[model samples]
Target: MALPPADDLPPLRAVVEAHGLAPRKALGQNFLFDLNLTAKIARSAGPLDGFTVFEIGPGPGGLTRALLAQGAERVIAVERDPRCLPILSEISARYPGRLEVVEGDALETDLAARARGTPAKIVANLPYNVGTQLLINWLTANPDAPFWTSMTLMFQKEVGQRIVAAPGSNHYGRLGVLAGWLTRSEILFDVPPQAFTPPPKVTSSVVQLTPLAERLACDLDRLERVTHAAFGQRRKMLRQSLKPLGGEALLDRVGIDPTRRAETLSVAEFCALAQAL
Candidate 1:
């Protein structure tokens, strides 16, 4: 008999149990078994019809299956856990040529190369341990020509707030500055911790970031340095907090008031400081 369509596969929990794959805390695995929720996330990434979707930590293929069923051109999932490979292979077999599973740490893999110069998007429920760092890696991968056209990611809610936070908000920090400087980011919606296989202590949010078609170009390291130092001592005045980076002189050169606190600076102001440095 012909196999069931890709969308008609058994429930995610069944598949996980069949493969003896239990969520591993060591690997930051919290599988989302709800297909409807996963599908909403897939659509939130915008049209995936002709773009490759690069997914990280696709435990049990919840979002992977959703991306394929939603019409992604291809999905290259980088999974660190060897246990999940079999399930992913099952997905690949069901979808035939549409899915490719790479067994490795996503941190070390080059997703851009995987896309092979084609327009691509990244959608994943990133492992908590490396989510922020992974985002930084992608954001700074190559500012001049970002490999992924857009990124739809899930992060701890507080972290998500920082990404889309504006100047003066308590959430505004290094992530906010960098993300705001490079792209337009917004929190699509909140995902309660209860949604996962083994729930996390904190709530999560799905955030989408689209690169600005035209943004003021600035050096990544310099921006990182400025934000790190400035926010490192967030309550201090620019003159005092930015002392390691030429402090008062740097602010003056960038036409910023030295007495202003780090949180007062806009994303553009932070970039200005970096460019001035």
Candidate 2:
């Protein structure tokens, strides 16, 4: 695909330098100066036309600008760092009504409220420090009715793998089970460490998740409790690990082998166990 034309605003590097913005480790900030990459990440969320995108940790508005340029109907960005406000404001000015910058912790922001009945997509290079928790919050926000149409997020490669991991895989755990129970997820691509302003020690990956129209019938809290216990002592057999819940008797009722380990259980099995509990 042909790269979108850069907006008339100054390059991200210049914006960062002019504003005295340095990628802060404490904030998990790693600015992406590569507009092409940003545009690619925005596009991965599928068509943006007529969609309002909620972006978290839009440091310096690199991805924010890309979303606007790529035809997003609107971009609502939640940024915690006050230092990036001026630069983000500059992008908002360039895009006029298309960009809205919210100055607050994304974890606390009520994204569904901000989306306001519009079709929403979340596209972000999430802050590493809180990326997983943010995703979990979104997934468990409304089990019966997900707020967004899709989510295209960048996370540390290991974390990304866990989101899309399958049962029986080494990476499979609570994250994988929870995500699989809610969405159809896959890793779209890997991003090298060198892509960011301050390179992280590990590579990054972009993962896309589209909510299932109808998720399996299970109590979200119960499922969470079941997985937590099962995977908390992953090396042990289910009979031992799940002893607090019911042990071999529980597995017998569910028809799953008591000797099976947590990693071997499918999302359906976990849901069944939760339902039984």
Candidate 3:
């Protein structure tokens, strides 16, 4: 006789306990066990009826389960931890062909390859240690041909602020300039510290990023170079801080005030300086 259909897979807590998957501090793991919260995050991605969603660091398959139950056409989950693979495998078996768990570091993996030309969106709580770096890498990977339609991601509150910050804000930095140059970003909602199994010391927030059809025509490499020099010594005025890169003369060449500080410059102004360099 055929066995009962896996009991629809027990609650995430049961899976976590069964597999002894306590959140590993080293891995920056903070499992979101609440179905309500996970479902909310899934919905935040807009409709997934015919769309493929990519998830990173799906520990215990909490968000993964939510995505499947929410009617995602397919989910390609990139999980790094070997220990969590078995748990994710169980979810895959339960969900059948709906879930694909790739075992590897997200940073080293090529997302475009896994995408396989499907209409895709990225939805993940993200690994805290490398989330920002991963985002920057993805945005700059092929700015001309952004693969994913949109991104719904979780980040530390400070990082979230930087993502949506204006040019004059203190939180504005290289992240701000890159995010502004590449995509239109906004903070969705804040996730309380208690929302996780092992709460992070600081609060977190979800951010939605949609790439602009056309961005300011500027060389990304040059933009990065300019921002790095400007923000490297943010406290110093442009004249003093940018001496290594041609100083007041450089600012004058770009038609920017020599007395201005890095944080005060708009993304366009930075791009101008990069182009002038």
Give all candidates' CA lDDT scores.
0.92, 0.93, 0.89
List model 2 lDDT by residue over 77-122, tens digit each. 9999999999988888888898888999999999999999999999
Candidate order (lDDT): 2, 1, 3
Number of the predicted model whose TM-score against the real structure is largest: 2
lDDT of 1 by residue, 1-277 (tens): 4324448788898998899989999999898988888988998998999898999999899999989998999999999999999999989998999999999999999998889999999999999999999999999999888999999999999999999999999999999998998899999999999999899999999999999998976889899999999999998898999999998988889899899999989988888889999
Displacement of the residue 201 alpha carbon in candidate 2, Å: 0.2
Off by over 4 Å in 3: 1-7
Off by over 4 Å in 2: 1-4
Span of 10 residues, lowest total lDDT, candidate 1: 1-10
Query: What is every candidate's alpha-carbon RMSD to the true fold?
Result: 3.0, 1.2, 4.1
Please give the ranking of all candidate structures by TM-score, highest first, separated by commas.
Answer: 2, 1, 3
Tens-digit lDDT track of model 3 for 158-192: 99999999988999999999999889999999999
TM-score on alpha carbons, each prediction: 0.96, 0.98, 0.95
Query: Among these predicted structures, which one has the highest lDDT?
Result: 2
lDDT of 3: 0.89
lDDT-wise, the better of 1 and 2 is 2
Superior by lDDT: candidate 2 or candidate 3: 2
